[model samples]
Target: MRNLLLSPFTLPPPSGQTRNCGVTEVLCEACDHLGWKKPTKIQIEAIPVALEGRDVIGLAETGSGKTGAFALPILQSLLASAQRLHSLILTPTRELAFQIAEQFEALGSSIGVKTAVIVGGIDTMSQALVLAKKPHVVIATPGRLIDHLENTKGFNLRALKFLVMDEADRILNMDFESEVDKILKVIPRERRTFLFSATMTKKVQKLQRAALQDPVKCAVSTKYATVDKLQQYYIFIPSKYKDCYLVSILNELAGNSFMVFCGTCNNAQRVALMLRNLGITAIPLHGQMSQNKRLGALNKFKSKSRSVLLATDVASRGLDIPHVDCVINFDIPTHSKDYIHRVGRTARAGRSGKSITFVTQYDVELFQRIEALIGKKLPAFPTQEEEVMMLVERVSEAQRFARIEMKESTEKRKRPKAGEEAADDGEQSSGVRKKVKGGSFRGRSKRGR
Candidate 1:
């Protein structure tokens, strides 16, 4: 259990250490292209072990560069033995799977590496085609991968060289144990394996025994803690005034991007619409949305076209957005660990950030649990009650418009056109539509203005 809290300035040289770990020349060049000047703590610890063709269990927090810890070694090995579908990386969420695939592609771009992202809510035939061609690496979610493994013909990982379970704890928590068991039976036993997780739960420990052989443990942080650079605080208010408090905070901290986390998709959508009506550039990303829309929202936020992103826990883990200056826990997570993941979205890669959690009367116990888990007593985020009350009128009007927009969106979904409903087969339903329900256009209407 090494202390990973050392400042980057005082950290040992990563380039010299990575070279000593047998990292290939092409991989180093790729790191340079991606502007990776030095490896993070997780990478410094796990990469060498993985390069030796040994099973590794990486225990580190989110935004710790775990992808490169595994992807680099896998790509280095792939360079030695050119093969399609050489490796498989499993993740809990579709967004994480796509993000990992993007990293693989960026790292292996010079070597002409081909990677395919197989996740649910997308066309099966298109993924099947990609599988038939047999990309160099296959990054997927467990359920969708099992769907392909069982249903799609001529799609098996017979010669897979590496197996990676990224965010193993979340995968098991999402109830993908059966799918993982099925995958294990199909893939070869005599292969390298890597299990990376933020927290090592009992299920993860059990999974380690079932999945790995003589694994080396590389733990950077043995306890639950947030980054030192993160400034965490809470706002205490009545439950009815939560929205007003959020508006006050956003207005107070204007010009900085925010990731506002809600507890449900409906709430996330409502809040995004509410913010949009008040001239805030906010977007929503939830599990219920189509894959293309989810990616579109993420891209918009990443490209700075949107300043605030309202989302559920789906965006909490493994989807890195480096420009997030603040994380507002609009709805306090019931699980304390989730609070860590949500706030981890900001203060990434040595950059300082802020996290403000809203604590209502109903959320007292949850907030206490989060404090206990993180081993700190958070101070209150300063707010002027008068200033917050001043915005109540505008916020109430926006709430009314948001409710109308939500009702209309629900009606549209329920009353799809006759042909559209009939033609909604499995394949056609997965495609991205030009028009999205409850889109930003509704926020710019006359009433919203």
Candidate 2:
């Protein structure tokens, strides 16, 4: 059923002043200090309902601060209870899990609420020991949590009262369906569930049915939701020449800091190498990398030591890197869902940002599919003169082949005589001059003379 609780919010210019509202007095004061003035459209509508301890399904964009919408309510709920780890959060990626835990810690720190993050790249024993301390909230990735649940003796979620699935679409994509199912089975049935995503499909709906009881669906944006803070641009180029084009664009831009999205790990690696060879700081982040390396790479990027990040769709979900001015789609994503996730990396937290997509003939279909899914046209940016010139300079001669000139042999050689055809037909005997039997009786001798 459609949730029609509030009048549809037509976004007004965000006032720079913080306002008192649904969140706790401390949270509101924190928002004031942080300049989180008005509740974002999603936060305004979803927070009150969520604070009432109802099951919530928040459909909003990545940068909409949906984290606060759910995090605030969870924090409020925890204030009334002294029990340890009354809430559980399941995130799709380690980076996201870390992000969630960090937010929870920041908000709950004043209240003395303890939180623990469990993900793969870190030591399992450390997580086990932390859980042994009985954290009030456990933030985990589905896989490692299952490993902990199955192996760690005496681990229990029977007392858990709240559960959140952040980026439900991403969790479902990485084949975490079975793991999530197992987690649901172990946790008690009398728990409040919240599922948040940018787009909702049948899979999310089914998961919601299994996990939530009479969920109050709150959709803040449609698939085509446009964030006016973000400026979108597209450039069409060929596949083989994309790397050089990207390098040229990077050099042209003043800020070297960028997050580039590629369709695959191999492509991401290739782009990273090209950028690095040009003395541009670049790193590749993808599913194939070890979690330790992934975390290390993310740290480097966060520290501003690495200016360019080349990544697959894996980087698109749940990871938060602040102060990113631009996001580039180095290759158009085949999946429409990924397109939203990729661009969402920039324009975060109400910061104005830009996203540019590189489209080649091969990516045209993918681009169209995304447009169809999002129900909006991605604005096309005119190719600058420099980009066109770069394209022309990089074009292969073979592909633009033009027949030119040929010259006859330069070295002087004895020409065969018309009547010496018979002599030429026979093989040379033992590499000798053969004298040609008196110069083949006459004509060959005249030519030699």
Candidate 3:
């Protein structure tokens, strides 16, 4: 039976069906212009309640259009009064903050709703300047917003009308509890609050109790679930020849866009470098990169200039990248919940996609935990041993090139250059596994039964 419970929603085909959520005519026209013909499931449930002036706790997975759920209502409220510095949206990461700001601008463009993003890696003085202008909406990371609240002259959220904590679980997971508390202390206690998260962990529950006032629970997915359209599979192989297998799969699946998740920032950079050397368009996005570079990488991948994006968990949550045909878990996540978020990058918005996880001998235990969490036994991904072995020579060559480039990049860390991977905080060096290559590529592999 289909899940009757609220779940990460699927977008319906663009039909003559209208998306009238009692939003103003201008907002309706804006939604139409943005091609949001019908709101996703989370939006359908959350928007109406929010329009009724109720606080909401939105439990929706990635790609469920939770942004629209909160955004449309906030804009509608702004329409009624047009209060300056009307809303404050706090996210765990800078990328998500910018994406929220982008949606706000799009949906509220006709009404001229100005938004400012406050996050680290960009100059604080610049962000302070933006705040001084008193934009109608401010989307920020907790840490950075805290910095401004404590340090910036004459900037505060005392009169903020709407407060949204997007990815509340992640924000608390990232140890921003104190920062969040500090923010809550400063904002008006009587304002409407929205807490949106994929999983309502205990920490999130505590936060909701503190932040919202008898909030309507607009839950889409409280379970650890993947989309029904996602085709899940795994490959069992020895750890040594992972690069060979990766190259083999990419060649076989040429023309499809991919997100290859690595365990560390350094590994993501190395994998992207290796893929580029072998004539694949790949880009790396991780925490070590500066804010500008991170956004640049995302834009390149989104614009389809890069066919594969090598990323750590930083790109996993709340980044709505389009046309991602597959997700390759190059390194299996130690935590099972992350596996859900990682693969959620693909098969979004009712589109069918595939996820192939590389289950090395060392990763079997971790991979098993993920299968158990998602409540399914994944079939093995099909692979030809001979085909993978044939890629050994070229893959080894690219590996050498990548290692040399990594060493050179490390030495040149003092000067940030165009196309240079920024120096990671010791985590990058740890991710590139050392292995003997060349004359022998010894590894066990299994094809799908």
Which of the numbered candidates is closest to the native, going by highest TM-score? 1
For residues 1-449, what per-residue lDDT tens digits would candidate 1 score against the true structure? 11112211122224655453557665787898988888889898999888777999999998888999999988877766677789999999999999999999888876778899999999999999999988889999999999999999999999999999999999999999999999999999999999999999999999999989999999999998899899999988999989889988887898899999999998998888777767677888898787888888899999999898999999999888889999999999999999999999999878899999999999999999999999999999999999889777778877876777776666656887775531111112222211222322224333322
Q: Which ten contiguous residues of candidate 2 have the minimum total lDDT?
A: 402-411
lDDT of 3 by residue, 247-360 (tens): 888878888999999999989988877776666777899998888888888898899987889999998899888799999999999999999999999998888999999998
The alpha-carbon lDDT assigned to residue 366 of candidate 2 equals 83
TM-score of each: 0.90, 0.80, 0.89
TM-score of 1: 0.90
From the highest lDDT down, the ranking of the candidates is: 1, 3, 2
Higher lDDT: candidate 2 or 3? 3
List where candidate 2 sits over 4 angstroms from the true fold: 1-19, 33-35, 384-449
Count clashing pairs, candidate 3: 2
Segments in model 3 whose C-alpha atoms lie over 4 Å from true places: 1-19, 414-449
Highest lDDT against the true fold, candidate: 1
Give the 10-residue window scoring lowest on summed lDDT in candidate 1. 1-10
